[model samples]
Every structure is written in structure tokens, then in C-alpha cells.
Target: MIRPSSLIFAAALGALAGCATTSAPRSGAAVAPYRDSIDLAGRIAINYSRDGKRESLSGKFTWRQSKANTDVSLISPTGQTVAVINVTPSSATLKQSGKEARTAPDLDSLTTQTLGWTLPVSGLRDWLQGYATAVDGKRFVATPANDSVVTRDGWKLDYVSWQDDAAAVPQPKRIDVTRIALGQQVDEMAIRIVIDPVAQ
Candidate 1:
């Protein structure tokens, strides 16, 4: 069964574009590390299945991230605030309307325990910016010709579009992420993120 927290967190945090195929490693320039701080407003869509029932959710989101912490707000199509999530290096918190806030020592554990899935916040922070840290500890950068990367933590990321095709290092406009089910208990999940052109 899909939990409400799963749907909420999926919309709050943030990709799948093409066939869930792995990308061959190719020569490319390294992408610069993500900035220390950013305020991004965008939309997110998620699709997953459980108990043989398929479900989907789409919502708007705003992400305010800094080196020390991050804040995310999930909004409904009618502009109502669905949930608020705050994350720090040591802890994470999630609050839904009229309910007690849920807290955990960290995001990975938090989502896994409460939402029944791994949100992979750490890896996602980089994937959202068109880069990834592979299991080997090497960084992979996204380029027009070579835009797909399989992350170290088990997610496949496809850089579907770029902010500026001509820029030396293009920012990701749309990122599609997919994770195949690890076991019968885990469902395959796909999330699509469309970042707005201008940062708020």
C-alpha cells in the first residue's frame, strides 16, 4: 500500500524521461559543484505502484537550500500548502497540515522509515544540479551529448534538457530519475523534476 507520507514526500522532494536504460560512461568536462545556496521553484511528478495498483501525483515545489540546511514546500494544484520539510546535516523534519511534525536523525532514514522508500536526499541534491557522485567516488557531469548517469546510490538520472545549450556548463532544466525495485517489497519509482528558468 502507498502511504500518504510517501505521496507527500515524493512531491516535496523531487525524474524519469526515457527507457530505464543505463548510460555508457563517456568523456566529458567535469561539472562545477552545486552552489552553497539556492532558491528554486519548480514542479514535480511521481509515479509508483504498490499491491498491483498504480498511482501518481503531481505538485509544485519550492526548494531553498544552503550548505547547512534545506527547506522544501509542497503545494497543491490549487496553491494550498500540502507539507513542509526541513533538513539539516544532523536531522530532518516533516510537517503536514494539522498534524504533529515527524523527525528523524537524517533524511535517508527518515524517508525510509516513514515513507517506506529511500528518498536519497544526499545524492538527489547533486542530481538536481546536473551532476552525480558515482559509487567509485568520481563525479559525473551532464552534457548535451552525454546526459545520462547512473548514480552510485542506485538511481538512474537522465538530464532531459539544459538551461542553456551553449553554456560551458549547462544547468539542468528537467531531470528524470528512476530506481528499479530492489526486491518484491520495494516498488519501482520514477520522478520528474522541471526547474524554472529563474531562481527565486
Candidate 2:
């Protein structure tokens, strides 16, 4: 049987997949890395651990974003779909394998209710662009290079490496994220994304 955490992880993966943007930076000019939106397809490996228990899932993902709507799909290693998540300004829905569709007022609430954990869905778009989304009462810090460590909202994101696509702006290749609570580490996740070369 698939573990609940695995389902949650898959849903979270789906949520992240929804943040990809389709727009590319112009050539031969410096441009801001973050775009208003994006669409992307790639592979993702998620590792989740809490209090010595750990779960890992690796699969393919697709994310499309337009204005306030985002759609994400997570596929298992065996080429079967695991989950699909749809997010909008007011609601989020998750459709899992062999399960009834679940909905909540937002992605965070939906994941918390169905997956028993909350993912940073609101900030993922910014995180995907190598930046942090601002939250009230939260402090965000970034490296001077803007390509390294980013800490915010009790999460520490390490930009391990970047992918250089010819004729396109380089994008993040590997990222490691850790969740902290009360000054102690509680959970961690890693994501490696390969932007579809043909999509650019």
C-alpha cells in the first residue's frame, strides 16, 4: 500500500509543478529571472522526513500556469499518473489514484487535510525562479550571488547548481530545501528540474 506521506509528497510535487512558466528571457540582454508565470515539464525527486521517519518519491511532472490558474500532474516512475493538482486564487483540488477528488479553500488547507502536511504552494512560484516570496513577519535572506542559499518562512533552500541552455537563460538544476522549527531541523526536500529544451 502506498503510504500517506507518499501521497502527500506526490501532491506537493504536483503543486510545485504548477509553478513553471512558459516565457523565456530575451537573448543577449540581462533580464530579471522571475516571470509572472510559466509552464514546465520535468522530473522531480522528493525526499520527506520527520522525526526519523522518511519517505522518498521520484517521478515526472508537468506544470502550467496562466494568470491565476495553475495545473500540475505527477507521474509515477512506472509511467502511471499518481496525482493531479489544480490551483486557483480561491481554491485548490487534488485528484489522486483510486481516490475521490478532494478540495479545500486553498492548496495549503487541502494538503494539510488530505496529506496531513502543508506545502508552501504560495511561495513555490518564486522559489522556482530562485527567489523567495515575502510573507508577513517572516525574514528572507539571499546570497549576494542570488544563486545560492535562500532562507525564509522556516525553510532553507540551497541552490546546488544551475543548467545552462544555449541561447536561453540558465535555470536552476538542483535545489535542496530544509524545514526548520524552533531552531531545530524537522523535515527536508530536494528537487531537481530539467527544463524541457524543446519547450524553450
Candidate 3:
């Protein structure tokens, strides 16, 4: 079984994966809206709770995405490396601190194995952009100013706030997410993310 601390690291990295990537746009270049495309780098603080147990982790992350693939890295608060994840159409790979690199068919499967639960890696790409994924049963609500909430496929996302960048459209600075599983007994996981916006 994975240790709780390792699970925390894995979960933190999983949460960081989709929003990490890309350098800032060049000076004088038009800033592409996040909803159109994203290449972002930022710092993140993650708080997670399950069954009444809570833990927190802080880190830096870089997320780069292109038409063909995506890559993300999570760095510890003290500047040590935590994990790296790469995703392609056919496969995903995760390299964690002090562990053998592992590969899986997809990001969800890889994170589920490493973290003891799955994160919404696929949906997060849209969630990070203040948009909802095109999944059945999904419900999304947004304010005229762009703050939003989304529920789909057993997960709920609350977009708490946006950064006040001068040149580009505001991007999410904090989000709270929860996943619920139904059965004889309900199981739930809660995650809170605090992001420090980058130039892009």
C-alpha cells in the first residue's frame, strides 16, 4: 500500500497536471485566452481531505500542451522535484520522487494506481479554463463575470476566484473540487487548489 505522504504527493501532482505547461507569451504578442489554448506555469497549494483526514501540500508546476501531447512537472515547496507526468494520445507516464517511473494507458489510470483514487485529469483541461467538459449529465453554472461551478461524472468543481492580470483575461486563482462515490456507504474526497498566476 502507498503511504499517506506518498499518496498526498501523488494526489497533489494529479491535481497539478492539467493546468501545468508553457512559457509566458512574448512581449507585445497577443495573449491567447486560456479557453482557446493554454501553456501555463504557476505555483500551487493543495489541500485534500478524505473520510475526515486532511493534508496539505504546496508546490510549483509547469504545464505545456500542444496539439499532439502534454507534459507537466510538480516541484516541492522547498524546490525539490516531486513528479513529472507526460500524456499522449496513446499512453501516459509518471515519474515520482524515489519511485520507479510508471506508465499506463491514461492519466486517470496512472493517478488512480499511485494515489488510491482517480483525479479528473481529462475534465480538468476544461475546468482550468473556466469551461465545462462535454460530458453527459454535466451541469455548469457561471456568473456573467466568469466565476463558475461545474458538476459531472461524480465530481464537483467550484471556481473560487480569478487572478487580476493586466494584459490577459483573468484566470482562475483558486478552485475547490470534490468527488463522491455512492454505495452502501458514501465515500468522498475534497481538494482545494490555490494557484499563483503566471504571465501567460
lDDT (Cα atoms) of all candidates against the true structure:
0.67, 0.63, 0.59
Query: After aligning candidate 1 to the native by TM-score, how far in Å is the CA of 140 from where it should be?
Result: 0.4
lDDT for model 3, please. Answer: 0.59
Q: 5-70, model 3: which lDDT tens digit per residue?
A: 655665455544453323232243233444434587766655566568776666677777675577
User: What lDDT is obtained when candidate 1 is compared to the true structure?
Assistant: 0.67
Off by over 4 Å in 3: 1-4, 15-37, 49-52, 134-146, 165-168, 180-187
Mind giving the per-residue lDDT tens digits that candidate 1 earns over 18-102?
1111233336564545565778888888777656777778888888777777788888777888878888768787777777787
Identify the leading candidate in terms of lDDT.
Answer: 1
| Candidate that beats the other on TM-score, 2 or 3, i.e. the better one | 2
Worst 10-residue stretch by lDDT in candidate 2? 135-144
**lDDT per residue, candidate 2, 1-200, as tens digits?**
55676576666765563333334433443324566667777777777765677777788878777677878888777888788888887888888778888888877788778766777554666566656533333323233244443344666566666565232455665666666566666655544554453353
TM-score against native, each model: 0.81, 0.75, 0.70
Candidate order, TM-score descending: 1, 2, 3
Candidate 2 colliding pairs, count: 6
Please estimate how well model 2 matches the true structure, expressed as its whole-model Cα lDDT: 0.63
Q: Evaluated with TM-score, which candidate comes out highest?
A: 1
What is model 3's C-alpha RMSD? 6.7
